[model samples]
Target chain A: MPYRPFDGQNCSIAGALAIIGERWSLLVMREVLLGRRRFQEIKRNTGIASNILADRLQTLVDHGVLERRRYSDQPEAYEYVPTRRGLDVNPVLIALMQWGDRHLAANGPPRVPVHTVCGHDAEPRLVCSHCSQPIKAEELRVRPGPGANEAQRAEPLLPAD
Target chain B: MPYRPFDGQNCSIAGALAIIGERWSLLVMREVLLGRRRFQEIKRNTGIASNILADRLQTLVDHGVLERRRYSDQPEAYEYVPTRRGLDVNPVLIALMQWGDRHLAANGPPRVPVHTVCGHDAEPRLVCSHCSQPIKAEELRVRPGPGANEAQRAEPLLPAD
Candidate 1:
């Protein structure tokens, strides 16, 4: 029912999904990042079946997103912590939250990120890597790159600006 | 098996999984935005099972991320296009790609996102809302907002910034 192969679509989007695209993998990352470190804590917060949770955690560890470390020698408990790889998923989670808050939300955002450095609401903005300008949704366009396919190279792929 | 509910840890992240957190939903959005409009094209690009693809497509349409339109009257062919809500997901995909490229890539990224405006490898940076400065990962934190629960408000929940 899960772990379906992503199409080797010769694209990074598909490439990323191929790694983390499981049933509860991203949610597991969410829980761990949100300070739900223990197995039972994560399971209780997510209502995920124990088998599925264990499986997802194992896969994430195998892929280097999480590190499995024992907390206590007496009780022999384990906690899931984000490696650099896992911590990098914050932007992805922010993106998802912004999208859900925009559409599916009935009230308002359930939680808001604070940019501790700037001391303000950390509204994730898409800033251009080169120009360092904040990219509004209308300010983007897609052009073929070196990795572009035949059709892509011939005709540029522009989604919504 | 499929519709697992995340109980409530950081409900924003949990709630995020409630929508785009499914297996193929984000990939489906990727294909649609990347100019794969037809059913067969999306299925081919995603490698998702037909039934699962159809179900995801239906859910996306129901949620208004995508709109289905008849492209031809003869055979009545349809195409999927991202609404504003759907295009909003590009940052999420880009962020995931950045993550996968950084940690998971064995040699190099399978593909890269080019900022068409500047024509360089575009790493979409998250900036602070108040000032337009880049928000570094380690320099961000969060506090309870108008939406914080009693438990969330009772304690200081500082996730890794």
Candidate 2:
């Protein structure tokens, strides 16, 4: 399968961006996640042009992020719903939202994520799954993993000074 | 003070995307975050053209995500470093990397984040700060916050049925 030019870096960040890194792509996902499923609804909410929206929708569906289902037959309307893969983007969206809320929002966070199970204003915290302790950005380092290519493996340890 | 068209929507995810949503923008950040500080080094690592790299670097500096500093007076060489604001993007990059590793990687993750303090491989898990329990995408919902626009305020509480 052909990959984006940048995907040659053997980096997962680049690999992910090759799929949903476009501004409009994630915005489309936001709409569906927020309950706007119809084409017109997504188009209006995103203010994205019809042709572009159509293309993005097709690509998303092709990539298994969204599933197009027939919602009505009279005029043959359809709704796009997130698949498990699409739902997996929640963390990325939350991270982006939290960053914007912290740095961009003048008044406050525009929307806050609530943990429905716990019933409290929930801010997502990244924790070490093994230790269950909060993980700070400066306190983490990257190392070559099983999939690392030869060049990637040869790179120096991260946070090089 | 100019903002993206979607900024008016008052959504933090959209707000953040307005800043770093472009494919190349985040990729450029990844390179810098991984210690590729020089212009030529970033360009080579990201495979981005010189013009595009220059444009991204300028934008990142303009937005306060990166700072440009002179490294050599004789040669007029400079290095780009991530500002505090830019370093805050670690969670976003980690989220993207994790997603790509889980769903897109053919072998396994090329790089793994290790918690420096714990000395163990760290997979960031989203936890509810209030409860300190891991939260999954299916377990979260969004609600209007102080910054919500009137229109957003009026929208049915999120995850609306």
The numbered model that scores best in lDDT is 2
Candidate 2 has an lDDT of 0.85
- Report the number of the highest-DockQ candidate: 2
Chain A TM-score, cand. 1: 0.86
Question: Comparing to the true complex, what docking class would candidate 2 get?
Answer: medium
Residues B28-130 of candidate 2 have per-residue lDDT tens digits of 8888788889999888888888997898889889999999999899888999988878888889999899889988999999999988888899888999999
Residues A6-105, candidate 1: write the lDDT tens digits: 5445566666676675547877877777778889988876788899888889988988889999988888898888887777777777777777667655
Clash count, one per candidate: 1, 0
Native-to-model Cα distance after best TM-score fit, residue A144 in candidate 2, in Å: 0.8
lDDT at B139, model 2: 79
Each prediction's whole-model lDDT (CA): 0.72, 0.85
DockQ for every model comes to: 0.52, 0.76
Give the C-alpha interface root-mean-square deviation per candidate.
3.0, 1.5
For each candidate in turn, give its C-alpha RMSD to the true structure in angstroms: 2.8, 2.3
The CA lDDT at A139 in model 1 is 48
